[model samples]
Target: MATLPGRRLLQRCAAGARCRLLGTVAEASPPREGDTIYVKRPASAATRDETSVEMPMSFMTGSVVGKRFYRDATVRRADDGNGWTVMLDYRTLKSPAKRPLKLPSRTLAMAIAAEWEYQESDGIRPFTMPLMKLACTALERVPVTRTKVIDNLMKKFHQDLVFCRSPDDNELTIGVHQKQKEKFDPILDWVNTEFGFKPVVYTSFFGGKQDGELTQAVETVLKKTTDFELASIDAMAAAAHSLVIPLAIFRGKLRIEKAIELIRLEEDHQVILSHYLSLYSGSCFSGLTVQCLIPPGR
Candidate 1:
């Protein structure tokens, strides 16, 4: 079976082994002054057990600053074909990848253009372009790449959080287990009843394979959705690692807070354990320590 690198990291951490991450974010807290952290060398490298390397965390710490390049932004229905396209004065608007930006609806195009119109002449930020980004993906990427995207997204159905159970052997662990079942199971049940598809749940990470019929049922339901909708579903499912969560959210079956709660359960559990360890060992954790638990590949 193929391994999910992220899941492998979680598995190592669950075993309580001290881990040195390679080509990924480190799970351990930052090495203090005079402290050393080992890094796994690439397999092609000569070192069998590479040790003691410090990799600077290169991340965007500040907002992007770009001079606004357009004087005015506008939208018009495409005489070309199916829907609307945004334009910037004399220049036709394009995606960041320089692909022509075409959208499926006049309303969506207007909204995206409005975002451009609202931008200050001094600077423009990519963070402010949610509608544009979604539209760009739908138009520029989805039309050509939908099959591969759908295939990758459908694989996540196997490891959905709804199908995973927490360990139930101890009071602390059992509390988390109960919390998961109480919080996550009814949603699963609801989806089953609503969709006529019941996802298979697993007590252990390695123990489950969703049955062919259930998988086909889910695929059929997805196949009926629009390409744009599938793109959104693929994005949300990848971020939360749960097809059920995104589908539920799309269907308005879960509130935002409930969705966040489900998505952050693992991080919350790690936070609790960190607090416990800090209390017992008298070691303090910086804010970065907790933040590091968030997977960077996202």
Candidate 2:
């Protein structure tokens, strides 16, 4: 499927550097003096203009390492009017590589600014700012790691969750298989129709292989995707454990809620089985509670 129209606009804006920032202003509460946050530059930037790069440092780890130092989070149009950026008071927000966090969509910029605005004064938790992380992955990582990312995703595709069917013989399998047929079959059908190759389904816990032509076709689609789109697909694919689901979502054939339901279908059935077994067989499985199995918000 082609990239979504909105994503197309974003890609165009990002490439041309010719979009105007237009959206609600995002502003954070005032800040207090604290330790400065420092992120290391990616090694790849060494070949580029030195002046273009910002803070230079060594590698660091952890999501919540930094303390809040900026007074407020806000959005501003770039000096060149090329795109919008999230500003930490007078300091511009940069990616981990110290590259400008230029966003093609003002709506996205605002959302990212909100993430920063929501940070606690004691710590700047990078894990909480998903939009900002995504933008950084798109801008700093995707271009350099495109092949590796796609290759890893393709590795997951061979044993994708949707391609594995539960055996229909067992009582538990009966419900799981029915659900799979009802929910997953349609996705497989769409993949068949879209890629012109039927995906292989098997009962093996190890997973099954798809056709070579189908793999190549899916890879081609991924290869053609824009950096932002690929980054998004990568995130969704990792979450769903099935590339087909993300492709369906991108194609507008599946809603995110439906996709989540599908992803959790068999797992939910297992939870039901555990409950039944616990009550009837006088045996309990540790940590089999629904709340633990299925977290809030699906």
Candidate 3:
């Protein structure tokens, strides 16, 4: 399974756990904010007490000030080698855990610095800074745990949501088939023509494995992606529960709206019904109308 970087790692506590940095369990008080700890878990009794714990990575541990802290946010070339780093007020920025924020690509570094530059005195919104998050994951997390994350995402690819279809039944059988062709077929055709790969589509949730050739082709593409790209793809794939959908969207073959439509294909009938009801029933009783007016993230 693909293991996410430390920043994405979860926090947990168990007795007798050892630390990653300090060899022995710190017989100290509970860990404070921004602290790293490893809770060891042995695989077998033969290797009992051999410490191996996943430590949680930190990000943005400092409190946000009302005003921007930096006079300027710019991209700077790395002093050690190739690659780039973001400079905040002439000083190099660091990750939440005090690690330097070095990126493999100049474009990636510039993108991150842009997020910092655009931040207002109001507050820091880390959630809005996806590029920065990806940079951190690439720098601190991916280098240590690349293999696990790749394997986990590969496993998820086979059971992608796009590969499964809603089964046809007596009443909705014809409608289901029609919807599949109308909505899903184009996406499949595009992949076949674009990638020279046609993924096997199933008519039921229990559908078996896809063609090995198609899976292999996908793996090949993913293997070539940078750590930043892979992290973003893994995230989008998990959210959509389908590697195909995210791949298409990322490559510009599909848009986010269309991908969302495909993900919710099983509810197409209900959506159409809701749309028509909203159109005919006027604004007062239409949930869809009310929802649209509410704006996003409400």
Candidate 4:
């Protein structure tokens, strides 16, 4: 059924056209805007049949801008023996207390534009996109020194940042942007396989798991309850210490393991915590100062 056309240029088309296979092509009529048309049956090279118009290549130009918005990302040294690090290189990372991060913003913008031009011809749209994020074992390149970068990141994407590191430079890069959201699984899998995130974090300014029995108690609470508490006494202080606790202020839709995985122990009576890591973590507690969940301290 060649609606709005006598016949289509394509002869071997499936339609209600009462035509037979021809060995020659036919000249057809030009098409108009906003017209409904279909290919005709058996086409030929020798027929000058007036039909539909040929479409211009410009009709398909291609792209989505970007996809997803993120604030922080985690990276680790492929061979530097460093645990985990976050690389911030966005205009937002230009903090007053930290060195301004350098991102390929201009370069990325150009890339996005080119990609969109190529993809727009198809039909898709996205927000922000994933790119390469890097991490350095040395403190010389921390995005911010005042607080844990993960803390701030959780506020933004509410999803854990995943990365793959370069063995030589410990830098991470995304092979492609605008990938399916499900693609994130492989990155998390890689992080777990490569980094092996154990539930322990240290109290040192760097933060990591310090091992022992309080670790056991922490594990038990997490296994049985949705959340827990942490009580500590500054073992180095003359008066008291602190501990680590798990807080879920805004972890609603976000996975538990993504952000604020652990908090310092607070008070001196008891402590509680849990692991979103499939509820799998061998807890350990050392001396640390814990304060109630408040923006002032974290």
Candidate 5:
């Protein structure tokens, strides 16, 4: 598993403490308003030097900002040779907590750089750059909040949308129940086989209980995942409202499109019903009006 460079090491390097001097590079253009400028200075430069600016952690707060500051965004290997880092002009990127943004792979670093490259001069929208947000969350938040994250997922496991079945007896829900059985039953069966305990399906809006062993099994799987994997799974689960769906995707048992279909099953069904009702009503009303206008003898 790839790890981030230690915080203390990066802090010492940032402070220019007992390190060799490297040549400095200046920004291509002057920074605009609200731009946080960080220049990678020579290691021998004094920490208090006016020319040297450490990368501010506030830049990674993922907030909306005005104007693009840098002329270019690029990726480079870290000086320590631990991992790849991104550069806006000459400044190395840092996390919200001021730790070095050491990405495990060059491809990921490049993808993030691409996000930066796409930013417009009028605004820098953090919402548009999902990859960067994911990286920051994995690097800055996951380690500190792992336990709470896992607990939240588990707490919602019993109430997962996939586990709550519509009653088959109701006329309005009969079609939905059939659809659920066709699409969801097989997944439940897979869950049973994989965990060695069948999940309890609930018709109640309140949700149902799963076997304690099954809960333990799922929690164990979550605990064993890497930080990046856990972060991704958490995001997927929140989107789908089903921990099982994300786990299935992670295990390669489900495709992303299919997971999306499952997530919107009920909503999609409602759309179909509305369309059919509109057509039926239009035809029936037209037929009645035509009959009313016709002569009785004819």
Candidate 6:
């Protein structure tokens, strides 16, 4: 069975992959006094009706930024290297649209929508192959919409996450977002089948089994919390290393570059767990660590 810790490791990889895939690389400037601005769907709440969604590009303020926008964008991979060089420029025109462009081939597309969207949110998107591989871990084939795409990724991510919540024992437990529950199920099934992932198991002393009360209570608590998953072989190692017991990181944003170091902090596992086994304890990490997690021990 994929252990509890393994589930979280897997989720992090899939989440990072998903984020990197759609995150656009963009920069923006505050709107000037009179320029018209274009916004996509679900307009910002701060604006009034007619102008609720539309803002003069000129009236923008604060860190209003622009992200990588392709008047037209294209991508092609190097025959020998493991990366892709994406090309993009401005101009609205149609490329051959009979068939979708395949990977390793240059890609181009055009939007024929009545009104095109202009977005200001910015961040770096994930690279392709990794995104595809991560998606394939659960979905037999990719679906077309953004919701479907996110669902597919979450399914793969959830498979290993259940281990952290099994009812038989209690170590630590976290919940999934309500809106994101369906997206997480397929992943749970996949991880359970392949990694021996178990559900959150716990027992409690109660007055009685009257009125489905206990189950309701358990469900209520689970519904309120959030946690990462753990499943694959690689995740197994990351989870074991993370048993920081007291110092392990269970929350907060830890990026890839720092993730590597975070995993390393617990690599030996014993390094931070002195009472369990000291001989194999990891060497002290020079960078911020449990030390960062707490104030100097009293």
- Give one digit per residue, the lDDT tens place, for model 3 in 2-26: 1221112112112322211101111
lDDT of each: 0.63, 0.73, 0.62, 0.24, 0.74, 0.28
Candidate achieving the largest TM-score: 5
The TM-score values for the models, in the order shown, are: 0.62, 0.73, 0.62, 0.15, 0.76, 0.20
- The sequence of per-residue lDDT tens digits that candidate 6 reaches over residues 203-254 is 3322112223423432343233222111122233334332111111222333
lDDT of 6: 0.28
Best by lDDT: 5
Q: C-alpha displacement of 127 in model 4, angstroms?
A: 6.7
Candidate 1: tens digits of C-alpha lDDT, residues 9-56: 346457864331212111343444322222334467554322112212
For model 2, the local distance difference test gives 0.73
The parts of candidate 4 lying over 4 Å away from their true place are: 1-106, 127-149, 152-298
RMSD of 5: 11.3
lDDT sort, best first: 5, 2, 1, 3, 6, 4
lDDT of 4 by residue, 89-160 (tens): 111221111322222233332232222222222222322212211211111223232133322322221111
Model 6 CA deviation exceeding 4 Å by range: 1-64, 67-70, 79-81, 90-193, 196-200, 203-298
Give the 10-residue window scoring lowest on summed lDDT in candidate 1.
Answer: 51-60
**In terms of lDDT, which candidate is stronger, 1 or 3?**
1
Question: Cα lDDT for residue 12, model 6?
Answer: 40
Error of 4 at 103 (Å): 6.8
Better of 3 and 4 by lDDT: 3
Error of 3 at 167 (Å): 3.4
